[model samples]
Target: MRNRRPVGIWLTTVLLSSGTLLLSALLAGFLAVVSFRHGWVRTSPLYGIIAFLLVSAIIGTLLSAFFSKKVLNPLIALIKATQQVAEGNFDVRLEPRSKGEVGELIRNFNRMAEELSHTEMLRSDFVNNISHEIRTPVAAIENCATLLISGQLSGAEQREYAEMIADGARRLSTLSRNVLSLSRLENQGIITERRRFRLDEQIRQAVVLLEPKWAEKRLELDIELSEVTYEGNPELMIQVWINLLENAIKFSNAGGPLIVRLSEAGGEALTTIEDRGVGMPEEVVGRIFEKFYQGNPSRAAEGNGLGLALVKRIVELSGGRVGVESRPGEGSRFSVSLPMENC
Candidate 1:
């Protein structure tokens, strides 16, 4: 989905530089010709010219080498690197040599290589993880179906197996839905259906929709929505709140407090959701927003690790920002800031 931009040519500068050296050599030769009549030339006038030309030629050779080191060496490295990259080796990296646009290009190319390598790693991990996740439910469903089809199964056994099959099917459905949602959000270009709507109200609705989870966990909700309205896709904003709130609820310890606050600050609508939950470590916090990145290993099965990634993409698409603050064994706080344009 991306292409390398064409770099500006340094050929003109190189030509000018080499031309300057040639001009200097010509000037030295002219001086040598003038000196031949001043009795300073011990040899023939033709010898003076030849000596000057030889010295000039040696310097020109050195200059050529300098220019080659400055320009051609890196290019050679780049060609080899490009070959590796083209052959499915994203690990190819170029060592930055000098300053200016060429240097910048080298740095950029190295960064691109690093990013590609990391992306390849993530893709491999995603494939493996997704396969395992799908297989677990599929194997369970197959086993449950086989048990139900057996003629020796009792009525209660048939019902249990059927319930298991339903659970497996639901799991597969959820996996598919999450994958689709993430794919859609990531590939979407711009926010559509922009309208001014009550952001706080939308959040409240999301809360009510997820009330069952909070109710089951005996968690308390303290909501302080301050008449905040925003301009963006309402459905997408709702999904953000749903993901944040559901995360808060899911990770929270039983009977803990969950606080959701919405207020206007610095020409932006700030929504802060804090939960008394099993928070994350610093390393985990840094990568929590990555796709299929689950920090809390114990609760890995509770999610497919796409919710926060989707939330981040949606908020960013709305020209807003999402921030997270957390510490292990301490509560976590998620702050989403939407620019209140025209507010």
Candidate 2:
């Protein structure tokens, strides 16, 4: 339906003004009748002045009401359109026939809606990426298990198939852990309680914890932290050191040297785990912290691909950051930085 506000306002203004004029004319007539008899203020002149005032008021009121309606209508429509856009309904559009500032606002609203639509598409693509990552490991596990079960094979063949099944299972476990950790880190609140402690002591503890794995591979530890001491979350930093050291051990050549150094970098406590190991490619390095992302898909490593991701998250949660430097043949270095408290 067409807006009748302007029409109704104009009609009301005219009717009211006419009523005032008629009332004034009636009063003037009454005054003329009474004053002609009573002889007060010369009835003819008083009547003329009242009539002029009534006509002037009628014209002014009508003009004001009409102009106010015209001015406010576009503003009201613009407000309503803005509300719709804020509520995420970008489909609403004002008539392009609207002119001046209001028209420009409508044009900008349409542009913003188009940009939001594109962002929604990108969000969908991210979902698809996560789904595909989850699906591949699961599919591999299913196929490998099926082959092992329906097999008629010798001892060596059975062992090989079993190993394949185990590898797939490990990868799936890794993928699940990374997804879970990402969810936690994104939402779970951090809790850090600081106490005075030796920083190198925590590194040594992490090394001792991973001793069995290193012994199995016959790896060597070249530690350099002799007197470094500071304070932070001992448990969380332990995880960082474990992850970095374990990663170094996992990727190192047989009988390779894994060097861990802890020292002061500015006022921050710095630790570096360097190993003569197989290094990551540039593409993998770029996405190393992403969920369910395995840098090397050759299954040469025994991790669930969550180790480095977890390391990064834990360090960040502890008010620290982790970095890596590596090359194809050269070893990789994982560095961790944390706030240092004087001990």
Top candidate when judged by TM-score against the true structure: 1
Highest-scoring model, lDDT: 1
C-alpha TM-score for every candidate:
0.72, 0.60
* Error of model 1, residue 40, in angstroms: 16
Q: Write model 1 residue lDDT over 1-343, tens digit each, in one string.
A: 2344323335644664578578767866897878987888777777887788778877876776677667766776776687778878997777787688778988998998898999899889889878877987899999998877776799988888899999889988988888887888778888988888999899999999998999999998899999977788887889899999999999999999999999998999999999989998889889989887888777876777888988999999989899999988888999999998875
lDDT agreement of model 2 with the native: 0.73
Model 2: how far residue 194 lies from native, Å: 5.2
Q: lDDT of all predictions, in order shown?
A: 0.85, 0.73
RMSD per model, one decimal: 5.7, 8.1
Q: For model 2, how does the per-residue alpha-carbon lDDT over 239-286 read when each residue is reduced to its tens digit?
A: 678878878888899899999898886778888899888987788788
Q: Which residue pairs show backbone clashes in model 1? A: none
How high a TM-score does candidate 2 get?
A: 0.60
Location of the lowest summed lDDT over 10 successive residues in candidate 1: 1-10
Clashes of each: 0, 1
